[model samples]
Target: MRALLRHALTEQGFAVEQADDGVSALEWLEGNDVDVVITDINMPRLDGFGLIERLRAGGRHRDRPILVLTTESSDEKKARARSAGATGWIVKPFDAEKLSAAVRRVAH
Candidate 1:
């Protein structure tokens, strides 16, 4: 999923940076300014929900677009993500085109 998202974003002219876990993601965000962030729900160190909460608490990334991509398809999970300030949600096994479209819509 990460590879697909990276490929899709790169193909659309985005220079992508990757992190294996939420801790690294937050660390990267400290020094970098990203147009958008796409993350999975379940990850080590800190989960996607925690990442969003932290981002929202921060200054620069609070209002930045955040898209949650995960295999979790439950309505409850989606609602939770929305409440956490996620811009959008994409279920796993997603089509690259669809994911790109969602990213473009939210990033703008």
Candidate 2:
């Protein structure tokens, strides 16, 4: 999944950084600043929802756009992610063009 996402974004000229899970993502974020964030709902250690919450709670990335990409498409989950500060959602297997477009839109 990660490799696929990397290909999709990179093909469109976007540089991407990946993390195994939310914990690693957060750790990477502590020292790096990105235009946007792409995350999955389900992962080991802190989940996407928790990651979004933590980012929202912080001063540095409070306004950062976060896009959720996962297989889950339930409205309940969408609402939960929205409430947690997700900027948008995309269900996998995602279309490369749309994913890139979404990233472009949110990144600015």
lDDT of each residue in 1-108, candidate 1, tens digit only: 678778887897778999999999999999989889999999999999999999999777989999999999999999999999998988888787887788778888
TM per candidate: 0.94, 0.97
Best by TM-score: 2
Q: Model 2 lDDT vs. the true structure?
A: 0.93
**Local accuracy by lDDT, each model:** 0.90, 0.93
Q: What is the C-alpha lDDT profile of model 2 across 26-56, one tens digit per residue?
A: 9999899999999999999999999999999
Cα deviation of 41, candidate 2, in Å = 0.4
- Candidate 2 stretches with Cα past 4 Å from truth are none
Which residue pairs show collisions in model 1? none
Worst 10 residues of 2 by lDDT: 1-10
User: In model 1, how large is the Cα lDDT of residue 28?
Assistant: 92
